[model samples]
Target: METGKRVPVKAALKSHCWIDANDYQSLYQQSLQDSVGFWRSQAQRIDWLREPQKIRDTRFHPDDVHIRWFYDGELNASSNCIDRHLAGNGDAVA
Candidate 1:
């Protein structure tokens, strides 16, 4: 099996601007050094029913590398997007 290719949407009206290459390179290096803390901070921004036990797991050879999320638990992405938002009394746009 092969990874799916993403289409290059150069002309699309993007909601966000691209990060500066130099800035991203530095940030990427820092993130690799402390991925758990970085990811934990990001996860805090979200309202999770059950917080993650393990922030990250990078135990694999590069050739057969695989990242496993919620290795100690589970999460429902669809429910979070739909149910949680509505539960918060947030308005929905048709």
Candidate 2:
């Protein structure tokens, strides 16, 4: 009931087709329940030069602080954003 708080609610139909409320809730739940699997699935959407075998690296001690995600994954942002879209949406404005 408070502002800036996240709460799951039923899906609602809207003009936008990218994502809906229910889909977002489902993704949020999956992210919490299986973080590694959730992130792996999301990573599949990108073009990785070297696919990552590990999803997370949280091996840290009280004195050491280090965290990483998709470790060792290599990807080109220009290729993913521009090259990949050249076939269908090259002329389309971003």
Candidate 3:
């Protein structure tokens, strides 16, 4: 039997990362204006792609519940994270 109770993993992870309210707002504002540029920079840092194209457009509204993602180039998140490694020595752990 467990001796002590613990918080759920999701909640624990969320609490581990803390962002300032002001910083989040600032970043969100910038993203609204130039989301493509912002994500392009992130892609470069992670070396996710050899050449990343600029984002076509992005729009965010406080009242709207949906977010729009648009780009001229194509990339699959699962492929990037897994498929790329399959050619060499990539395998999932048991």
**What are the clashing pairs of model 3?**
none
The residue pairs found clashing in candidate 1 are none
Candidate 1: where is the Cα deviation over 4 Å?
Answer: 1-33, 62-64, 87-91
What TM-score against the true fold does each predicted structure earn?
0.49, 0.77, 0.38
lDDT, candidate 2, at 75 = 89
Q: Tens digits of per-residue lDDT for model 2 on 1-94?
A: 7899997543563554577878999999999999999999999999999998888998679898789999889889999988988999868888
Off by over 4 Å in 2: 1-13
Cα lDDT over the full model 2: 0.88
Question: Of models 2 and 3, which has the larger lDDT?
Answer: 2
How would you encode candidate 1's per-residue C-alpha lDDT over 9-89 as one tens digit per residue?
Answer: 464534365665577797688779888776776676666668888876766887888787656645678776776678557
Q: Estimate the TM-score for candidate 2.
A: 0.77
Ranking by TM-score: 2, 1, 3
Compare candidates 1 and 2 on TM-score and give the better one.
2
How does model 3 score by TM-score? 0.38
Q: C-alpha displacement of 11 in model 3, angstroms?
A: 12
- Candidate No. with top lDDT: 2
